[model samples]
Target: MENKIKILLLEDDDNDALLIENILTTSDLNVEIIRAKNKESYLELLDKLDFNIVISDYTVPHFEGIKALVELKKRNKNIPFIFCSGTINEEKAIQCLQLGAMDYVLKDKIEKLIPAVKRAIKLVTETLEKEKLEKELIQFKRAVENVHEVIFYTNPDGIILYANKAFEDIYGWKIEEVINKTTPRILKSGLYDKNFYSEFWNNIKSKDHFVIEMINRTKKGDLIEIKNMISSIYDANNKLIGFISIQSNISERKKKERELQRAKEAAEEMNKIKSYFLSNINHELRTPLISILGFSEELMNEITEPELKEYAKYIHEAGQRLNQTLNNILSLVELEKKRIEIKYESINLTELLKDLINQYSKEAEKKGLKFITKFESHKISIHSDYEITKKVLSIILDNSIKFTNEGGILLSVRTEKINSFTHPVINIVDTGIGIQSEKIEHIFEPFRQVSEGLTRTYEGLGIGLTIAKQLLDLIGVEIKIQSQLNKGTMITLIFPTVAKEEEIKSEVEKRKITIVEEPYEKKSTNPEILLVEDNPGNRMLFKKYLSEYFIVDEAIDGLEAIAKAELKSYDLILMDIHLGSGIDGVEAFKRIKSFPKYKNTPVIAITAYGMTDDREKFIDAGFTDYLKKPIMRTELIETIYKYTYKNN
Candidate 1:
């Protein structure tokens, strides 16, 4: 089998054309030869057919080898061309070669045609392959230049070597200007110090790749942030050659992050200011309220006329409602701040609910509403914060009594097994003005009220249910409400139960106790009490209420209280927290406790800042007990008797 070769021969002699074909045939190449004796035939062969090689005589009738070569060049074809002439000069041969001729073979040396033709064909094939590769390289360069991200190449010394068009577009710098220039330092915005760059370079050199966010300045001196991903380019022998980097602009993203941080900081500062203002406002309000409530109760107890006593009762009730409103505001603040802490203890749910029912039942009767209780189990126990749970129940029961005008309220309790646990669920059903279905979803939101007009009958700050829901959620309890407008509302509270443990004896003793009437007696020991307060009215009012039962000693501020405390040992010390123009009560208590005689002297914190965490704060400050301001006469006496009489 012979390899095929197509040839276009421009020669006037037919014998010479036949001789050229015979040489190629003997060289194991199948020759497909087309003869063109003149310019007309040569042009026709070139236009009509594809030939691998062209052979022409140096001198024909009018057309020659140079003309043929010039014609092939006009067509812009890459086919190999050679001249076969018997009378060609050396200069003419060099001229033909210079004009893109592959080779020239004399007619006398026609045997050399075979080798010369093979060389020319081999050279053309290599040239075509090289041209194809050059086209692909051009396409690849175009793609890199059109990309959006800034791309650059740098030497191992961090000197810039090459940059794409995107680099110029983004940084406003031509490639000629940046070549051989060191990066980062030229573009540094001075946002970072030398230590930052030192560490960054060390990391990249060790890791061989690095991505970072940095602030830089453009040629226009505008500050911009960029996220740069850099990778080290290495040779096949694992030697570091250079680095390539792709950078994306992130100035807008960084600006947004800074704005959000500023906003967060502003909000935090505002919250601090609000909390401080509320604390001061609470103290100012409670101080006057204590005087009003204390004096009113004293008048109610000692007044002889019926009408005057009723007036005193009204004043006390009004003060009580105002104090409750203040407390609700503080509680909502604490809940929002997430400062309400739950102290879990083993609780007797049955006893706690019964006590709450008894307390609210009298209020229900006063409002001409019947209060009923149903218990499916007598001994229901759960682990929860006893005080918080009691407050939650009181809030629900008070709302029921306040909203109900005609019908009654029913309280029910039961135990059911739910999801591998026995849960104690309490239900409060009221036949009051029920909530609308659409409004039920938002009922638990703070300060939300169903009736919102000046002439509205409901009297509340509308935070009872909000506080109840928050407190219930804190203790891992679930609540459900079902209501119908103008008919009734039922609320269910489900408490997670704990396994039976040893009953808390202290909790049993803390149950509601009725004050027993003392028989008239003349000879008795009078309990000594220390009243530490800054407000003169609060001191006078507290003395008037307490002086009837005990001998009271007064101190105007924490410094005076400390002086008096060291002088004598009292049965109990009532310390007001915010002592004006002197050391605070907490500091005075700490000083008094340093004395050997007053170490165990039971100091109770009587403070106006009665938020949810107030008691915990006092307890942590080494107080034996805590009480909120605008204190009732009964509660005050009971707290004293518990610490004094019970211990004795």
Candidate 2:
């Protein structure tokens, strides 16, 4: 388009030259013509600038047609040469064409010469442009091949025209296989809709480009998600050629997204369960705690005898034990939910066992059982969370003492060498009511005490093993058990030990801290406790038991509890579920916790409904602890000790 094309006309005859000039003049073309009357003149014209089309006579007096074409082709092979002669031979015409002449024109049919020349000129221009485009296309293809994304070209009929190395790598198919295969048949995942592809093609044709996400199958039959951008290609005449597509493998990202969604759903479901259990636990605990506290308080204040006061103390101790069990249950839930942080340390196994033995001596003596230690190592240390390990050991020993009557409990420890590392094993053998054959497998599960009916009579929350199991899991320890129905139970624990111990020198004796009790303070020693209840007997008994610990506050319904908690500074609250009045304890706990001042204060639950999941729900609703009625004095004391002593 930039340079004007020049034309060379060779005709020794003046009349033929005039006719050719007339045809060129009448044609719609922009070209400069040069006439060469002799061989010398033609050679001189060749030395000049370039020509787009050459018109020469076949039989000139001095120069021959084929020779002239050969010379011109030798110089510039791209320039189109046409023969305009009255006596043109078929062989010569064929030779000229083979030598790169565009076409031949007859002088006798001068009218056809202009049309022939015009077509030849147009073709020359088109061929030259096509050659330029082909060069650019080669460069573009090379660049696309080097790109990281899998690039491919395909026709409307779905036959692949070209594919890069990346495409072959992604599909596990060779370039030859992909180039000959149809798009859908080769890589269909059967995850796309017919309408989806229809719309995809429509957009690509109409808008020139389209982006989509689809699942595709590899040659190996592995399914992968791909993000693709496809664009339609066109030639100079604006004719549709094919499509060029670039894609990336997104299977890993899709997997992560799906896993995240599942985790979120699981968390939501657990939260709902937690809420339900919390409400039930709170109602169960508060009812008994109130009874134990109130009855014991009244007896101590009214009896006025030292011997009678001892009975009240015993009641208090029983309530405290029940409360301790609730706290431990809550702690297990927190551990399972990863709400608690454990501090890791290097601990001496020898010292740890000795400490546990000493702590459980008094309890074992009360149960009329002796504790025996089998020390496999006089000095052994390992890397672990010392406090948690101690708790685990203490629980096993306590359970052993609780169930055993006359037989002694044995604790043993040893180490095993395992391929460049040492593993520690601890065994606890108790001569107690051993686990039943069917119950052994599920003993570690929360709220499940053996069907021996011992739990109902014995003082325990049946959650100690649950906590121990969770704690051991956190530290990568495995616990195994072998038991006979009524003879004895042997529990084994295995854990990896660290040789290079980072010795912890702290000698802090683990003891429960008690807050300084202010006797003469004007503040009520018995803080007002809200008792939201429905049953008249239960409410009366709850008030009677709790009178010793706090000022008994009454709320016949959940609405009353919420209203009272909003207006008063009750130190603690005891909420009952299934109130005869409007709203339930669950709704009441939510409303009470919603208030800023009551958020951190402990709220004990008293309910008849108790389940493994109830503890988490109660805690989630802002209840500090939960107990099933009728409450023991030890349980109440333990729950009070947790909140009161913990705050202190």
Candidate 3:
């Protein structure tokens, strides 16, 4: 292997051995020769020395070159052996060559010795390099076969040259059957059109690295989705020799993706249907409920008989309950759909709880239960959505009053420093029929209620807490509840940020400033009102109510309302949305507002479209104010008086 060759020679004649060394030294092979004359020294030296070439005399006194060549063959060394004999028969020379001697040079014509030695060195070097390369190739094959991904290589002609073990296992084919015997078309499933195949071939040839998702079939004809990557393998001369492909099975993943897509489409369809149903149901139910509640309140006021008045009161109360339930359902939908907007404001937590406590106190007293409160500080406030905060507390306190028949409800507030920030925490402790420990965790789940004793007296839609929790989470507030069986429940409302005292005072002063009493002057004894309603019964109700305070003019639809408004200037207008097959209230209002005289006149939105978004939509459409239907007498009159009086 080294450039400096070492040769061992078995020669009795030192003169001849010196001659061979001188001839090799003249060449550039860098020769080193050591002489062994006899049989024992010669054979022992052949076994011990790691020389490149062995040269020997054919017939020494005790040594024969034929015997040494036979020994070299037995040792299985690939070293080259040569003979320079004084007397060698034709049969003996042939036998020596057959026994694996590389070449022989006759002593008479000794010029052939250097050429024979040169030939021997070149052959051995080529053989060694070939053997080393074969070992490395085998190791590379083993590594590729052990990976999970399918790996294969093909020649430039698109003929499969080699494939790893994973390729055979995944494709259900033996490696011998595919290698050098098949092309990529053998696995094509024909699921794609001709254009797909054309694209596939073009991309691989044009790009150095190409990846595509393909549906290919196994040997057994089972389709499989795979993501395949092909990269060109180039040789040292910068010529493309072959392509290497790696494939990952994605059949199961693709199946799941298809299923999810279908489910999404189905859900979208259901949402559209639900919106249609909600729209219809809102108008259908609230339209009649408006008449029921309105007429019942009217009857309760005018009826003289005690029994008749009590019946009217029952009708109004039941209508109110239905209206509240409907509101909760729509509110829960808004919260679930993430359509509710959260606007944070500084609110006086003390005054908020006091207002809620005052509102619910009468209900609790009517149930023969005491309502109590303890404010740790009268000045604690929080930066949160005021309406959402009020609604969450209202739900908890209302639930408390409903569940507790005879037990008192205690509402308290205290301030604490959590994580270096002041948080105002409101705790509502009620001695009601408490919930089980296992049920406390699921109290915020929609439409989920736990009745350990299966109490049938409590009534609710069961989504109040769910809505409360979602609204609080949107505003970054936290709530916690602790309860025991029949012992009562303690709920903690943790506000995220505590507002400064200056903010509370500023809000209080703003409210106080708006309460200034001003001298009132009536525009006329009877202010005119244009009542626009499509429903005949609703039209009569509105006209009857407003007729007492204004010279009421009636219009059955938006067209009529616009026509009447053009003919007469009124103090205020009650416009109902969804007026039959004609235009809606918003379009009619826009038309009237186009006139300079009616642009500033108050046109209130009174509609049965009671979804959470509908109220604000009307307000944003430039209505003076919005009032949901199923309207009560007090609410309708008060809203009307606010716009009509405009004084104090």
| Residue clash pairs of candidate 3 | none
Off by over 4 Å in 3: 1-149, 156-159, 165-210, 217-222, 236-240, 271-279, 299-311, 336-338, 344-354, 365-384, 405-429, 452-457, 476-479, 492-648
Give the top-scoring candidate (lDDT): 1
Q: Number of clashing pairs, model 2?
A: 45
For candidate 3, write residues 1-648 as lDDT tens digits: 676777888888989887877888887676788888888887788778777788888988865778888887777558899999877888988998888998888988788888898887887777778878998888988889899899989988778998889998899989899988655788989788889887788778887776667799999999999989899999999899989999989899778767866786797688767756765676688889889889999999999999999999999999998887777877765654546776767788887777788899989999999998888988887777889888988999989988887789999899876533467889998888889898899999876876523675567768889988877766656788999878899999877644344543343344334433553234555567788887898888777656644677777766567666665678889998756433457667887788788988999998753446766777889999888765654457667877876642
Ranking by lDDT: 1, 3, 2
Candidate 2 TM-score, true structure as reference: 0.39
Better of 1 and 3 by TM-score: 3
- Local distance difference test scores for all models: 0.81, 0.75, 0.79
RMSD of each: 24.5, 24.7, 23.9
Residue-wise C-alpha lDDT for candidate 1, range 28-140, written one tens digit per residue: 55667888999999998898888778999998887877988898887856888999988889999999999999899999999988888888678666776889899999997
Worst 10 residues of 3 by lDDT: 507-516
Error of 2 at 261 (Å): 5.7
